[model samples]
Each structure stands twice: as structure tokens, then as C-alpha cells.
Target: MRVLIWILLILALAIGVSLLVGNNEGYVLIVRPPYRLELSLNLLLILVVLAFASLHLLLRFIHYARDLPANVRAYKENRRIRLGHASLLEALHALSQGRYQIAQKSASKALDLGEDPSLTALIAARASHKLKQKGQRDYYLAEAERLAPDAEVARLLLQAELLLDDRLYSQALDVLQQIEKIEHRFIPALRLELKVQLRLNNWEQVLVLLQQLEKHDGMESWQAREIRLQAHQHLIERHGHNLNTLMNYWKRVPAEDKLNTRIAKLAADAFIRLNAGNQAQEVLEMSLTREWDSELAAKLGDCASTNPQKQLQQAEHWLLSHEQDAKLLLALGKMCMRLELWGKAQSYLEASISVQPCAEAHLTLARLLDNRGETDAANRHYRLSVQACEDNK
Candidate 1:
């Protein structure tokens, strides 16, 4: 349809030109300095039109010729950019599929073609690391850093994460601390720093870093508890023999966290180490009231006081609520034996064995039986204790 329209328009133009030119009966005269010329108007008009057309064609050719180099350069640049983009996509795909060597080649190609050279170099670094080409990976990382000095934070973070993955916790910590100094409490960096501190047994720093993480929602509540538990256990093991230092550390912990079972046990044991029986009793009792733990009950039983009967009564009170808790029975048995309540000690210890046959409970019962001069029964329990300890080992 477009072709037929163009043909009709061309035919109309031809007919109109023919009528106008065929009836022309005019003349043209041109006088230059050297000569005068005269011609028919139709010829003159056709010659003038042809001259203008020729001039337009010549000027157009000159314009195109002048711009040729620029246009070619632009075309080459566009093609290079396209190739780089395609190479980048291919590299990412290969990296995802664990084709490290292919990814490394493509990333280098992208860098050579000038596609965000710094980022591509980092990609090459990652690919090299995946291929276990440590030298190549280090070269690419250094090249990336050189190409984009403004990307120091990103470069450092990646290096730190890589160190962390390699279990080079001290090295990772060094990098992360520098980032922390500059970036100031970046959440991801803080998380990494916490792990590093924990790995290095920096208990005080672990607590500090965890608080920082908690402030930024970098650590969950349960996760904070778990990490804190590990930190507190370590601190307790280190300072438990020093009464003043242990108390100072315990006081620094928040009251709500003091009820944590593991921490409470640690505090109680530390207090027991310093012969602070009442204080140890208080820590254990405080934790038990908040959350019932059988293990804590057993530890509570070990807190000896001058008045054993009173302590026994206090432990026995828990039995009203936790009737069949074996650890509670063991705790009661231990206290009863301490007070020399022979029959009651015997009953609680045997009941503990029925509920949960623990080696420690068996040994305690065996000693109580020995005190009662029941040699054969005591021997049986002593043998059971040895078997249980071996099984546990």
C-alpha cells in the first residue's frame, strides 16, 4: 500500500512539472564582467536547480567525511561496552554454577574491556579464590583496591569475611576493628567483630561487642543469651577463685540476665569457691524461682552451711511442686547425708536412682550405705557408679 501511494504521488509531480515547463515562453540574461550571456528560461531554471543539488551533495559528502573518525570511535566504544556487559553476565552465571576458571576468564575479559573495572576485578578475585588460586586472587584483590581507592570499606569487608571463613579469626578481627573505627558500629561489621572476639577468648570484649550488636538488632535475643552464656562461663572459670573480682563481674551483669541458668550456676559455683554459701544459695534459688532447672537443683544441694537441717528443709520445699525430679531428690539426699539423717537420706537417694540413675547420685547413695555399714549394698552401688562413669566417658 505504501509503494502504490508513493508511485501515484510521483506521477502527479511529473505531470505538474511537464505542464509548467512546456508552456514557459520566457528568456534569461546573465552578464558577468568578461561576457554577457542569454538563454531560454526553461534551460536556465533546470541548470540552476541542478547546480544547487550538486552543491548540496558536495557539502553533505564533506560533512560525512569529516565526522567519519568520530562516528567510528563511538561505534567501537559501544561494541566494547556491549561485550563487557555480556562478559559480566556470563561471569556471574559461571560463578554461581561453581565454574571458577571460566568465571575468572570472563571477569578478566570484562575488566580488560573497561566495564566497571574495580567491580570486575573483585569478581575475578572471588573466582580465583574459588579455584584455590591464592596468588591470582590476591593479585585481583590488590588490583581492585588500586583501581577504586574510594571502595576501601567494601574491599576491607570482603577481605575480613574471607579471613573469617578461613578461621583466621585474629586477622579478621584486625580488619573488622579498622572498619569499626572508620564506619562506627556498622551492623555486619559488628557481628563479625563479635565472632572474632569470641574466638580469641576476649570475654570482656565479647560482652562489649555483643552489646553493640544488640543495640543495632544485629544479634537476636536468644543468640545474645547463648553468646553471653559462653562468655560468662569463661569469665567465671578465669576469676572464680578471686572473690572481689568475681563479685565485681557478677554485679556488672544485668539483674534480668542473672536469672540465666548457666550464668546463675556459674555465679553459684564461684560463690561456693569463696565459701560464700549463703550467696551461692541465693543465686541458685533466684534462678530456680525464675525457671526450674534440675541441674541447678543439684548444684544448690552442694551449697553446705553450718545449719544443714535448715538448708535441707529449703531444698525439700521444691519437692512439693517437682515431685519426681531426680536431681532435686539427689540434692535432698546429699543434704540429708550431710546432716546425718540416715533413713531419710537413704530414701531420697534410692528414689533419685529410680527416677534417673546418675553416677554421682549412685556414688552418694553408696557412701550413705557405707556409713550405715551395709557393705554388700554399698559395693553394688559403687560398681554401678563405675559403670555409669565409664559409659559417660
Candidate 2:
């Protein structure tokens, strides 16, 4: 339909032109002193239109010719970019597959092709590290640092993680600390720092890291508890001989944490070591009242309070609730013996043996009997204690 309309329009324009030419006596005249030139008006109009079209085409050709070298360069650059992208993908794949040498080569090519050189440099660094090419790894890492100074934190994090994997704990710890200085709230850095501290046996630092990690909910309750327990145990050992420091540290520990059976036992033992038996008794009694623990009750027997009657009463009271608990009976027996209540001591010790038959109860009973001039019975109890010990082993 368009072709038909154009053909009709052309015929109409031809007739119009013809009519105009026949009806007009228009002409173009160029005159000089010795020459004159003339052309029909229609011809001049056609020539003017043709001259403008030719000029536009000539300028277009000249423009293309002038830009030919630049255009070729752009095309080559585009090709290189495409190749670089492919190389990057290939490098990533090889790295994942553990083909370190191939990954490094491809990543290097990607960088040379200018495919986000900074990123490619980092990839190459990882590949080099995996290949155990320390020199190459350092070189690539340096290049990455130079190419993108803004990514210093990221590079440092990678460096720290790599050191951690290699078990270079001290180096990793230094890097991790650097990360903490740079971005205090970064979760990954906090997590890594905790691991490094633990490995280095920096118990105090581990405890500090654990507190920070808890704010982020970085660990499960059980995991946090386990780590906290380990840190406390180590710190307790460090202050073992220094009674003042150990008690001071325990005072600072959260009250709720004091309820943990192991920590409570540790504190009680430390108090006993310092001859602060009353203090030891207080810690053990507080924990036992909150929750019954056989181990803590056994540790309860070790507290050497000045008033044996009071300690005995406390054990007997616990027995009312935790009836048939052999450790409590053993503790009550020991407290009675301290006060020279031989009959009650003998009865409690015998009852403890009937309940649990542990070596401690047997040994305590033997000592009570020996002190009361019942040598034969004491010897029998002593033999029983030795037998129990062997049986346990």
C-alpha cells in the first residue's frame, strides 16, 4: 500500500513541476563583466538539493574515515573485556575445584585483560596461597592492596583467615586485632578473634571476646557455656596460689554463673586452699540450696568451718530434702567427726557406706573408728576403702 502511494505521489509531483515550468518564465542569471550564465529555475532548485545531499554524504564518509583507528581500538577493547569476563568465570571454577595452578594462571590473565584488576588480584592471591607459592601470593596481595586501597579491611580479613587455616595462630591473632581496630562491630572478626585467643591460651582475652560475641548472639547457649567454663577454669588455675586474687576474681564473676556446678566446686576448692573454709562453705551452701548436685555436696565435705555443729546441721537439713544422698551423709559424718560426736559420726559414716559404698565414706569411717580405739573395726574399714578404690579403677 505504501509503495502504491509513493508512486502516485511521484506522478503528481512530476505533473505539478511540468505545469509550473510551462506557466513561469523564471530563470537564474549570473553576470560578470565579460561572461554571463543562466539556468532554468527548476534546474537550479534540483541542483541546489543535490549539492546539499552530496555534501552531507561526503562529510559522513570523512567522519568515518577519521574515526577508523579509534573504532578498531574500541572493538579490540570490547573483545578483551569479553575474554576477561570468561577468564574470571573459569578462574573461579578452577579455584573451587582445587586446581590452584590453573586458577592462578586464569586469574592472572583476567587481571592483565583489566577485568576489575583488584578483584582478580585477590582471586589470584588465594590460588597462589593454595598452591603454596608464598612469593606469588604476597605479590598478588600487594597488587590487590595497591589497586583498591579502599578494600584494605577485606584484604586483611582474608589474610587473617588464611593464617588461621594454616594454624599460624599468633599471626592470625595480630591480624584479627587489626580488624577489631578498624571495625569494632564486625561479627566475623569477633568470631575469629575468639578462636585465636582460645588457641593461644589467652584465657583472659577469650573471656573478653566471649562477652563481645554474646552481644551479637554469635553462639548457642551450650557453646558459650562450654567456652566460658574453660576460660574460668584456666583463670582459676592462674590465680591458684594467690588466694586474694582468686577470691577477687570470683567476686567479680556473675552471681548466676556462680551457680554452675563446676565453677562453684572450683571456688569452694580455692577457698579451702586458702583456709577460708567458712567462705568455701558459704559458696557451696548457696549453690546447693539453689540446686542439688552430688559432686558439690561431696566438695561440701572439704569445707573446714570452725563450727562443725553448724556444718553438720546444714548437711542434715539438706538430707531432709535430698534423703539417701550418700555424699551429703558423708559430709555430715565428716562434720560430726570434727566435733568429736563419735556415735553420730560412726552412724552417719556407716549410713553413707550403705547408701553409696564410695571410698571416701569408707576411709572416713575407718579414721573415725581408729580414733575411738576400735582398732579391729577400723582396720576392716581401711581394707574396705582400699578394695573400693581398686574396684573403682
Candidate 3:
């Protein structure tokens, strides 16, 4: 539409100029030294317009010619950038698909083409690691660090993760420490450090990391609970040989964690092993008061408190609520035996056997019968104990 409009305007102007020129009686004369020239004014005007148009076209052509080399360079540079971007995309897709070799090849190509050098190198590093090519992986990681010196945290994080996968825990921990020096509270780095600590059996560090992860919501509640339980159990065992150390450690344990049955059982057993029966009893009571566990109840009997009657009272109190619990019955029987209430012990043991028939209850009952000179009954109970153990297996 614009071209048609321009063409009509040009025709209209030409007709107007022709009518004016045909009516005009004008002329232009040029003289120079020995030569003179004369031309009609309409023709002179046409020559002048054509001369201006030709000069504009010639200058435009010259300018285009002058810039042609730079334009070619720019086009080549743009094409390289586009191809590098495509290669980077291919590398990312192949990596996600687990085609490690292809990912490595494409990432290397992108790196050579200078497409975000640090990212490309890191991709190649991960691919090499997946293929178990440690040397090449290290090379790429070094190149990544060298190419992007400001990305220390990213480089160190990847290094730590790869070292962890290799089971090089100490080295991984060193790398994580480097990251911590730069950004102390990084969540993903903290999570990786937790695994490293756990593998290295640094139980104290494991506990610390668990707290950090819990605070940051970096771990599931149930997962943190399990790891925390394991860490506390190990710490308790580590201090078990010294009664004062064990008790001190127990005192520092969080109140909610002390209520966990498994952790409570461990602390109780550790205290009992160290002959700190009062501490064991305290731990068991605290745990059982929060929630009754049959295993913890059974462990309660093992605490040889100075006051046997008091321990027996505690077990009997638990019996009011857990009457059908076989382990609790066995524990009550053991407690009763400690207090020399033979009749009560016998009754509780028999009740435990009737309920579940475990080896410990049968064996304890046999010992009690043997003490009373009931040889035939003791032998029968002993056989039953052996049979129960075999059935359990």
C-alpha cells in the first residue's frame, strides 16, 4: 500500500512539473573561460535532482563496503554463541538422562566454544565422576575453579559431593570446611557435612549438624529423630566406662530425646554397665513415665539400685497399666526376686510365661525353682527355656 501511494505521488508531481515547465520560458547558461553551455531550466532542475540521488546511492554503497568485514565477524561470533548454547543444552539433557559419556562430550564442546566456561566444566566434571574417571573429573573441577574464581562455594560444594560419593569422607569434610569458611550456614553444604560426619563416626559433630539441619528444615522430622537417637546412643556408649562421664552426658541430653525408648534403653544399659544403677533407674523411670515400652520395662529390671524395694515398687506401679505386657511381667518378676519375695516372683514369672513364654522368663523361673530345691520343676523349666529360645530363632 505504501509503494502504491509513493508511485501515485511521484506521477502527480511529474505531471505538475511538466505542465509548469511547458508554460515556462526559462533557461540556464553556464560559461567557463573558453566554453559556454546553455540548457532549459526544466532540464537543469532534472539534472540537479538526479545528481543528488546518484551521490546519495554512491555514499551508501561505500559505507556498506567499509563495514562488510566487521559485519562478517559479528555474524560468525553470533553463530558460535548459538552453537555453544545448543551444546550446553544437549549436555544438560544428556546428563539428566544418565548418558554420562555423551554429556561429557557435549559439555567439553561447549567449554571449548566458551559457553559459560564454569558451568560447562562443572557439567563435564560430574559426567566424568559418574563414569568413575577420577583423573578427568579432577581436571574439569580444577578448570572450573580456575575459569571462575569467584564461584568458590559452587566449586567446593561439587568437590565435596563427589568426594563423598567416592567414600573419601575426610577429603569431603575438608572441602565442606572450605565452603563453611566462605558461607557458614549454607543448607545444602550443611546437609552434606552431616553425612560426612556420620560416616567418619564423629558423633559429637553429627549431633551438632543434626541441630543445624533441624533448625533449617533441611531434614525430615522422623529422619532427624533417628539420626539424633543414633548419635546420642554412640556418645553415651563412648562415655560409658566412666560413670561420672556417662551421667554428665546423660544430664546434657535433651529432655524430649531422653523420652525416646531406644535412646532411654541405651542410656540405662550404659549406666548399668558402669554400675550406676541409680542413674539407670532414673533414666528408665523418666522414659516409662512419658510412654511405656516393653523393652524399656525389661531393661528396668537390670538396674541394680541400692534400694531394691523402691525399684520393685516402680515396676509394680507400671503393672497396673500394662497388665498384659509380658516383658513388664518378666521385669516385675526379676525385681521381686531381688527383694527376695519368692512367692511374688514365682507368680509373676508364671504369668509372663503364660502370656508370651520368652526364654528370659523361663530361665528366671527355673533359677527360682532351683533355689527352692524343686529339682524336677527346675529341669522342666530349663528345657522349656531352651525350646523358647529355639522357637525365637
Candidate 4:
């Protein structure tokens, strides 16, 4: 178009100059000494202008002709991009409508147009997955991964989710680990990593993840503490068969923690297993001191009265506070009987039966009375003891 315009312009100039020259009588010019040339100046001017204009127009036309293929290619690329954009929009709409087949078709068509190859690969992969085309889905995913080595988080997350859904826990962990290696402490990746660790029973890894979560206040304090406690308990139980490790671990646990009723109970059992009744007694005493637990109090009293006079004193001190509880009363009664304090034993046994009647208490009192030569009262109490067990049942 520019070439045609230039040519027209040159033609108009040529015609104007020719008319001016034809209307003029020829103009003469003088030359250097001993030489003169006669010429029509206006006609000479027109010829020179026409020659330059022709050369310029010829060069322009040659350049434009040389660029024709490139222009055609550019036009085709632009048209393809527009089509791809339209196809992508249609694919997205179809996907939203749950038309998996149509979405796959449109996405493929979009990829065939001039869309970004990496983006095209992802859309095609997702669409194929939705359509249950496993082979095609894997191929597209592989292609996308190759094209964009720096994979998108959303795509990686989806892949991990799929692996998890299939119960491919190790594979899912591998993916999450890769993401962590690339972008350490990425929140979603770390969360998925923790979940994978939990699924695999990698308790050590879970503890570390829990610590990280705690730093961000991501988990409630009690929740984190509960998980840690569970992990610690598991670790302890795992090594419980090894006496040295179990003893060492138990000793290293903080004294305050040992006062927890559950911990105290477990520790007491462990101590009994190790034949360290004294340590068990100490744990029970500490636990009872913190809170009045009938269970711990009873265990403490039992342990104290098991062996010697010193532990008896400990049982007596505990009983001073819990004497009203029937279980504690029974414990005290048995301890006094073991010590041969028959009178004190009878007092406690009677007190226990009075507060909360139990077959054991009635029988213990009856036996004390019988041994003391009160046979008639002993027989009465014995019969009442038999009836008590049956009535409670």
C-alpha cells in the first residue's frame, strides 16, 4: 500500500514538472571559460526528479515483497491465539458444568491452537484426569512437568491429594518432601508433610512438625500437648522391654509431670514391675498431694502398708485426710490388721461399713469380732455381710 502511494505521488510530481517545462521557452546557462553548454533547465530538473523517485519506489516494492511471508506468518499466529483463547474459555465453562468429555475435547482443541505449551499441558492433564483417561492424564502431566520444571504449587498439591486418596502414602510423602526441599517452610506443603508423617507412624517427624505448627500457633496448645504426650507415651512403651532405657526415661521425666494422675499410675505400675516399690510410693504420694484422687490415695495407702512400720506412718497420714472415703477406710482397716492393731482395725472396718456398706468391710469386721470372742455379734455381722454382697449385685 505504501509503495502504491509513493508511486502515485512520484507520477503527480513528474506531470507537474513536465507541464511547467513545456510552457516555458528554454532557459540558457553560461559555463566555464572557453566552453558553453545550452540546456533546458526545467526539463533537466524534471528528468532528475523522476529518476530518483523511480529508484526509491522500486526499492520499497522489493522490500515489501521480501517481507510478505513473515507478515502472513504473524497474521496466522495472532488468529490462532485468538482461537485458543476462545477454546480455553469454553473448556473452563464445560469443566464448571461437570461436562468432563466436552471439557477434555475443548481443552485439547485449545492446546492445538497457539496457547502456552506448559499451560496447555496442565489444562489437558486436568481434563483428562476428570474424564478418567488415565493414560492420557499421565502423559499430559509428564509433558507439563517437562515443560515447566518449576511446577506450580496447585498442580503439585492436587497430585499429592490424588496419591493420598489412592493410599499411596509414601509417594505422597515424597512429593511433599520435594516441595519442602525447594521451598522450605511452605505452609501447605508442611501441613501435608505432617499428615503424611502421621499416616506412616513416623512419630519423630510428627513431633518436629508439631513443634513447627506450635511456633505459628497453628494448633491449639492443648492439641499440640496432647499429640506430644501421645508420642512420648508410645516411645516409652516401645522401649519398655529394655529395663535400662525405661528406667532412664522415666527418671528423666520432670517431677511435675510425674504428678499427673495418668503418669503417676503408669509410673507406679512400671516401678512395681521393676520392684521399686519405694519409688512408686513416692510418685503416688506426690500425685495425691497435688489432687485428692481416691484411686491414687488407695494405691499409696496399699503400698505404704505392704511392708514396714515407716510406710505405715505414711498410710496413717494419708488416712487422716481421706478417712471418710469407704475405700480409704478399708485400706486403713487392712493395714491396721496387718500391723496386729486389732482394735484400730475394728474401728476402721466399722466406719467403712457405716458410710458405704460393702461385703468385704462387713466380713472384715465380723472376723475381727470373732477373733476377739464376740461370737454372737460376729455371726450376725457375717450373715449381714453375705446379704450385702447379694443386695449390691
Off by over 4 Å in 2: 1-78, 164-174
Q: Estimate each model's TM-score.
A: 0.80, 0.77, 0.85, 0.53
lDDT for each of the candidates?
A: 0.88, 0.87, 0.92, 0.76
If ranked by TM-score, best first, what sequence of candidates would result? 3, 1, 2, 4
Q: Give me candidate 3's TM-score against the actual structure.
A: 0.85
User: For candidate 3, lDDT tens digit of each residue in 1-393?
Assistant: 999999999999989988998998899999997999999998898899999999999999999999999999999999999999999999999999999999999999999988997799999999999999999999999999889888888889999999999999989988998988899789999999999989999998898889998998999999999899889878987998998888788788889988899999999889888888888999999999998788988987788899988888878888998899999999888888888989999999999999998888999999999999999999999999999999989
How many residue pairs clash in model 2?
0
Clashes per candidate, residues 3 or more apart or on different chains: 0, 0, 0, 0
Model 3, CA-based lDDT: 0.92
Model 4 vs. true fold: TM: 0.53
Residues 144-215 of candidate 4 have per-residue lDDT tens digits of 676666666655766676667567898998887777777777777777777787778777777788878878
Could you tell me which 10 consecutive residues in candidate 2 have the lowest summed lDDT?
299-308
Off by over 4 Å in 4: 1-161, 251-259, 301-323, 326-393
Error of 4 at 150 (Å): 4.5
Question: Which candidate, 1 or 4, has the higher TM-score?
Answer: 1
lDDT of 1 by residue, 137-232 (tens): 888889888888888787788788778777898889889878877788888888877777877899999989888888788879899988888889
Q: Which candidate leads in TM-score?
A: 3
Model 3 worst lDDT run, 10 consecutive residues? 245-254
